[model samples]
Target: MKQKRDGGVAVTGTADKQPNAQLTSWFVRSGWSKGELARQVNRRARQLGAHHVSTDTSRVRRWLDGEQPREPIPRILSELFSERFGCVVPVEDLGLRSAQQPPSGGDIDLPWAGPQTVQLINEFSRSDLMLGRRGFLGASLALSAGPALLEPMQRWLVPTAAAPRPAAAQGPGAGGGRAARLSEQELQLLESTAAMFREWDSQCGGGLRRKAVVGQLHEVTDLLQEPHPEPVARRLYRVTADLAALAGWMSYDVGLQPIAQKYLVLALHAAKEAGDRPLGAFVLSSMSRQMIHLERPDDALELIHLAQYGSRDSAGAATQSMLYALEARAYANMGQVNKCHRAVRMAEDTFCDVRAGEEPAWIDFFTEAELHAENAHSYRDLAYVAGRSPTYASLAQPEMLQAVEGFRRDDVHQRAYALNLVGMGTVQLLMRDPAQAAHYTDQAMAVAKRVRSERVNTRIRKTTHAAVRDFGDVPEVIALAERLSEELPEVAEPA
Candidate 1:
């Protein structure tokens, strides 16, 4: 039996008990001052109502040896390192995975292990970063291993009476029982994870790695369900809820509608438990986006309304823009041209109010270029519904071109450019220019090869196939269509 910290373990004689050497190396390479890291962790712990406690280098050393830190401490550690290094650091870096690792039978014995909390926060931050980069590829992959890990984690999070008391009750001078302190090393893990996730979100699509993100969400939810002091529990719940919402969004983007819905429901419950009304609204908005994709215009519209009503007082520009944009999408889908335009105008106005450094952490994905690109999509949709060729052609060309340019320049974003080109192909087909339509469709097909996004590939195939059908006899169109069909066999199937 492997010896575990916090309790006596049944140890077989002569088994190795060395700490993880890789983790030790990572810590040394991070270049953070031990004192500065400790100070940040202590400060964050206080903010979260953790009992004031003196933490030192020796305490951190224990963490490096694989001991999990107590509540609020894990979060504090993450915050401190993230602040210091300007990047995310997950608790796993501190060897917390040993604590969260399942037994031989693949069952995690301690659902609310302190180390698990650190891991959860780290994953959440990573998911955020992934979403900001590439939409939601991570969620698409959730079916592979995410749900399995999450279901069990959620099962563990169901509240229990024997849960540990809050850290504050156990502080140095005032306690019959003292809650354990998180080590400085653990805090650094949290910080590193957050920064890494932020970077990933900016550079890659969340849909591609959603399974890992959901796995993290499950762990956070489990932590929230465990017994902790009210203040500590509340803070944990807020962070978990935010991550869960992001999980749902990434799920939706990857076309996992049912899975996305499940995540959204759980996120809503978590948000309510945390008393985070704004987060709940954000989750609803994410659901609205899913509804729009499914072409359930009425449902999407209602979700938009709910989000707007719920977040009316949040005073957040990004939230307002998301709500308005969702509303605009719903109206456009329903062929309510005037209403769509009005909603879009409101979205634009809300975006204008978004001062730098003032936006909430969650809605950081909306860049100026992305916003205009979305507006162009809404216009294109409205044009289709209204049978207004000129309007569609005018907005589609420049917007799609700009979108393609932005995405193509960055390898991480090239998939999006391909998808935008598919939209461009549709617009060209609508304008009766099969030649230009074929050209853009061919470009989209070419770009699709570099990305693993089924959603983008599917859209490209559909649009290109439609264009081919419209001009099947033309030699250039036939050749382009043939090439695309070979690359994407799904396009050869009947609509």
Candidate 2:
């Protein structure tokens, strides 16, 4: 006889019997006994569209003993914790051993030599270019974390040979081409193209134009296979760096991770080859943002700190402000309220002092609006993790509304506008304003129809879950939850 499949979840037996410290930690925080958790999981399954799945205290005990529950259960427990704590508790955070984790050594720890960076991008962007929604970290790969993710920064910061091309050698992705000569006009065109891709990524989501951008980045790698004049070479690498970073950022926005890491490392390499420390810092910070999304704040902080320190001499005030804001968000994710506030203050002060046109073209996006949006996120995370602390909630409200207003004022920020609306809605729910929360969520839904962002969808799913769990009795909240459930796909992350 086969094992029963409970509402599409194929039951699997436990494989190990070690103590699960992480799961135990979250369980302890929940203040719920084993049986109570089992009951909640069952109830939550019903809300999540799995009406017949069931668990008992024995199952909970097995989970505590490191037994990985199949499918809906892991997702169910994650949502339960998220609702219980008022923050996102990713399934990976539970420390359950899954098929997704692969073996310990599958991490993407690419070399940081500038030449290797170009080679890496040539191969990666070609592979990534072919990936139509490559999904996140499929077989044979896991989301890189810990030392593997951080070690490359060491080479990037103090590269032995940042860029050297006595003889040109290209990877397979680089089609056979003679030593190339590029003009300033062509370089400028590439730069403008990268800028356009960035704009498209911000307005729409990564899903729509990711392939086009990856194709562009891949072509740049082909150009890098041969040496041009050093001046022209520098410009080529700069454009490559821009495209690679934008590609990584866009992929991340659409829930792609493993390849996103590779692209970012390539971006950092290209930036270094161009002798642009500020651009390298930007790439590192972009990686930091990925870590934060994966619920690895410690990793995010390391990357953020490295970015801040490495670029200190070259990065302008505006860039520094962006770094500080990311720092605040990392601290906030860790629930360090004081540190978060301090970092936010630093970001604000730095932004206030940035002179116009003093920063690079890339730093133009980190205006008052973007800075506050980051700050709002910090406060939002703090409020959620603070678990009923009204102080952070109060702080989140104004800042989030400010971000919403700021994004709404810019038509190009369509995705940001949608994302901020989702954030604002969640903040309202935290403030006990269900009606206002619903109103903002409704606005987010409308805007999101025009933007193709999984990140925005992620926020909406989390917010809707929150509203359903916390304010289910409110008619507006329930209606919004139902609409969201009907509209959004299941929330899936690297775990």
Candidate 3:
């Protein structure tokens, strides 16, 4: 809750410990000219969900003259300096620190109360849908940057001391009708549309209908502003959270990880407001997946613990199984083979007990196939840690193949199935069978052509890299390499 110093004029009394000196020294050490610093700061601000800023060298000059930039600008400056210097650079160090104030969650806090959550979602949805708002850093820093986003979530870990009391519905504003009784038909329509969106995302990849889902989520937020009976309001919050979470999931699929993180955090807010502890837990679990993909295994582990904490004892077999599966992945990344194996066993055991209707509908994607596929990935990771043992490859190939086949039988998530095909291909290549690896890779490409998933493309790239690096001289590898080179320049001829 640190405040920034006033930007109006130069402050006297400490010229020897000059704020200007600190700014100048750091600015010089950074090797970025004043203009470059301005550009980078503005970019980072946008990523942190700040209003549009076009800071310039003149603004930097003002800082050098002992005047501070207001509020978040100082915070943004600290972030850039810390990232550039590889150390913690507090606002105090930047000479812009002022008296502490109450924490408002620094632009990312989800209001779990009433209409504020709806307003937050509306603003976020609009900003995200507008391509002009995208930062130059893109989505890569979403989870990788770590603490900025995690700090807010860490605060969310503590439950509210008082339970939320429902407020009377507000009368119609200029935009829409007053609070009205929520009809059964309205809820049914939302549920059906969500189901349809899920099907489309699974079949054709998130790119096929991501915008549609986000727009629907914005529409659903309107229902939150309307007054309903306590029960109806609670149900409305739950469904809205579900839609928001879906939007986040699709954003992840299409490689907009920052936007995905934003929506997921908002969804977590809505879920908590609805008293849907299980859904809240799932959102944390989803965030953990994003962290792992960002290569932040330790951060991912923290999110896993938070997820399990939310579920406590009420989580069903399927939910518990999925959580453990994610834990196994986290451990695998950390090279904790024994812990990873134990978690895999836990997931396997719990999934065995999952009854047909035990799982929430949203988690229908976490079937036996996903468990097997993730288990294979965990095992494959152990092999890397243990010096690439052929034994692990032998074990991994069958599990990945089973996953691909399972997805095939369901006739859903073709992108996932294709990605697993690439996994199997990689395992075969590691086991020194170029011909079989080529066969699997070809099959994967055939399926992959129908989907627009960055994740699928990433797997395809890995498979191709293994082929070219290890067995490029082989005729089968050569042919597949040629095909990949023609189709994906980034994968075949990486910079």
- The TM-score of predicted model 3 comes to 0.75
lDDT winner between candidates 1 and 3: 3
- Model 1 ranges with Cα > 4 A deviation: 1-207, 229-231, 409-414, 491-495
TM-score of 1: 0.60
Work out candidate 1's RMSD over C-alphas.
19.6
Tens digits of per-residue lDDT for model 1, 1-495: 443322121212224445646446655776756665555555444433343444667656655564555434443454344333323344444444432333331322223443344444444445544552322322222121123323433333244343355545345455444433444574345434444453454444455566666666555555544444555565666666666666766655555444556566556655655666677777777766666665567767876676677668874887788688778878987999889889889988988888888865666656665666677778778777777557756765676667666666755456557777887777788778888888888898887776556667668767766876788887778888789757877522111
List, residue by residue over 1-495, the lDDT tens digit for candidate 3.
233333332233343334478777888899998888877766666665564455778878767777655546766676577646634465667777533322443445555555677788876776666642344333212223356656677655567643443355432342333457667997888878888888888888877788788888888887676666667778878888888898888888876665677788888888877888888888888888887776677878888888888787778888889999999989988899789989999999989999997677888888889999999988877677678778877778888888978988878778778878888888888788988899889888878789878777767877887888988898888888888777754522111
Model 2 clash count equals 0
Candidate 3: worst-modelled 10 consecutive residues by lDDT: 136-145
Q: What is the Å distance of residue 155 in model 2 from its true position? A: 2.3
Write down the lDDT of every candidate, Cα atoms only: 0.60, 0.78, 0.75
Between candidates 1 and 2, the one scoring higher on lDDT is 2
Comparing candidate 2 with candidate 3, which one achieves the higher lDDT?
2
Q: Which is the leading candidate under lDDT? A: 2
